[model samples]
Target chain A: MSQGNMNLTLKVWKQKNKNEKGRFETFDAKGISPDMSFLEMFDVVNEHLISSGKEPIAFDHDCREGICGMCSMYINGRPHGPKQGVTTCQLHMRSFKDGDTIVVEPWRSAAFPVIKDLAVDRSSFDRIMASGGFVSINTGNAKDANNILIPKYDADDAFNAAACIGCGACVAACKNSSAMLFVSAKVSQLALLPQGKIEKRDRVLNMVKQMDEEGFGNCTNTGACEAECPKSISLENIARMNREYLKASLT
Target chain B: MSEKSFFLSSSIGKKISMGLTGLFLISFLIVHVSVNSCIFINDGGITFNAAAHFMATNPLIRLIEIGLFAGLILHIIFALLLTLENKKARPIGYEKINGSANSNWYSRSMGILGSLLLIFLVVHLAHFWIDTKIAVFTGKADKHNTFNEMKEVFSNWYIVALYLIGVGSLLFHILHGFQSAFQTLGLNHKKYTPIIKKIGLWFSIIVCLLFASMPVAIFTELIK
Candidate 1:
């Protein structure tokens, strides 16, 4: 069981498009390096498929360093694999045993239909973001950083929330396919800042209305989304969003 | 949006209503468990019947009982609607999923546990509640005392088994529901949330253990 010669079985979901049915296709991933990233392993497998005159599996990736949030593969029944606080691009093959049969699939949500083998059309997130994930400002140069006197703790929390890369991992991991963690992180990042205060009411109201209309499920506070988030987004953002929504709705 | 549609159409609003109603039902459990504990006084239904009779005859208690029913009804309604909506959110099922890796089983199965509790409630209301509360409401004078009813109901091993299963389901249900209700209300904080979760664990254990022990004690003739 040397670190280098790790061979494994990969059962990947293969879907032609949103309208077509999907099925799991197994591939023999051979001569995989332990140090290689999960996506790199996929690259090796896709290389094998292409060499055999088979269709290359379509997936999404950018900034292979983890910040872009594009590489989403529900590996071994966990979004972004077994590692905590790491995206698929950051996950290493050393986490799995040499003889393991890994299961990989696209994000399963009605709001995020599978566009290809492992890529989903997460444009629903874009629509929700468009509804209100912005702060209004005058047409001028950006304000100086030190001008706004935000508490250090508030800034840190906002930063933590702002770390969200709009990945569909939260929705993928949720039993109900709820986007609360994603939306809450988006909402909290803005709400904690003074700039977000101007349109706080309408922002939450419009964003939530759009969220509901997009067919995402309800949050039951299971904390799965937070657990699966690569950025380590806290469930407190969800509670904060709930409070903000309540305040906006009532007033 | 109008007040009615906001609660009906919005997901967060439905969750908020569920949380509020769930908290109300939780408080009622305190009253219920406390009254049920009176049977432990073991004076052969004297003190137990007195508390039961007072609960039945008091006007304020009757009004609170109405509110309790309303709370229970709302809790059930929202739970059902949300369950259906959540099911629809994932139109296509996952080929393979590991739910336990990310969340506790009870938290994910609230709908199933709640349905079990609802079934238990019907059997329970028929056994004791119809005997006392419904009798008082319908002006029927003769019925068994609350203590004797407990003794009789628990005398049958089958009925006692059902009660334990009901209490067991409630333990897991409350274990998740208590802290969940608070979080849904946006009351989560780093400092306070840990305390809330600890309290919720202890409360669920204490309440469910007390309830579960009742049926076992009666069946074993430990309290009679």
Candidate 2:
């Protein structure tokens, strides 16, 4: 390894299933290469766990590439560990030094109940989406992408909102446990799209209603969600959502 | 629990309360500034004092005052609870919080600034509300002249300075609070987010400047 080697003490959460009681179990990881990804180090730890008659700490992961938005973990005290815009799988051990004591936990929102160990059931995100995330485009109603001819400004704005991956990191990071950023992104993405114009009012109304139903906290404008988000989603989305809601309410 | 009733149970409900209460308080600021501006219209403070006396006694105004008190209490309570929850949520700070550089400074310090503003509110109510209420109840002011009372209060340079600093903190808070309240209500579309944010900033600055100007003008003898 080009980077120096290091040892770490891991306090990993272990739960058998959603209903199971979980606790932190300590493990010593020595001979870890600093360049190894955080998940890679986890892999080494898991290998040791399996060989030592222990169940490996189960976690949710799909794309180690940070794009899947599946790697949700509270590293030290931050969501997706400490590295900005990087998932836990993408974070390298080089960010830490030898003999570091790493504390890993799951997202702590009431909306995000733990499924097991470091994995949380983020289906609340899916529910919020199902309430009103997409345009009501029907089959055989295909339209040319450029036919709508949205202004460049609107196009760019929609793209920024569409970049949200439905991760619950914002909820995890917000002091109020607010999901305004996520709901606003969904509302904004469609509101900006030309095809979404037909249902803009209904879209915001239903999504916000569902967001409320899901038990998310109100946004206090603290911006912790934006600060900790792996996607760098802007708080501007929340402002847009507010405008949409106010307009919708008037109608 | 019933799904429809879960709004109150959800994190989103807490946010909605925070937003609504915050916006409501901002409206109170507008009224307060307007009433305070009456002082400029009356150089001898007679007209302003009469108006202030009328406002203090009006039934409608009293009703709204109760609402305002409820709003302030809820705003502070929820703010404290939210801060504590957030602290418990992320027990450790990040190592390299990437993209944090992109967020606005006001957005990050909502809690700290809010606390300072809360402290300012306590002193403000004590200096103004308590004394005024006491005077109103006792009918002790020279013909119920609240403006004279205000003049006495603002005559102190330290009091004026404190009001200026307090309003300044409030301005900083509204800069973030206005937009964030909307976001909490789930208003996250991009087309208008930037415009709302700009409006929030300008609104904060304008209102704070106008309110702060009262004490400043009084202290400088510009309004005498």
Docking outcome class, model 1? medium
* CA lDDT scores, all candidates in order: 0.90, 0.77
Q: Report the C-alpha displacement of residue B134, candidate 2, in angstroms.
A: 5.6
Error of 2 at A173 (Å): 1.4
TM-score of chain A of each: 0.96, 0.94
Residue-level lDDT tens digits of model 1 in B1-224? 22223645799999999999998999988998998898788787788788888888889998999999999999998888888888899998777788898999999999889989999999999998887866787775345377888888899999988999899899999999999999999999989999999999999999999899899988898887
- Estimate, for each residue in B50-146, the C-alpha lDDT of model 2 and write its tens digit: 7777778788998999999999999888777766755544443333233353356667677878888888889888877887788768876446666
Measure candidate 2: CA RMSD. Answer: 5.8
Which 10 consecutive positions of candidate 1 chain B have the poorest summed lDDT?
Answer: B1-10
Error of 1 at B26 (Å): 0.3
Residue-wise lDDT of candidate 1 within A46-129, one digit each (tens)? 898899999988999999999998988999889998999999999999999988999998998989989999999999999999
Q: Interface-residue RMSD per candidate?
A: 2.6, 5.9
lDDT of 2 at A40: 87
Q: Judged by DockQ cut-offs, is candidate 2 incorrect, acceptable, medium or high?
A: acceptable
Q: What is residue A54's positional error in candidate 1, in angstroms?
A: 0.8
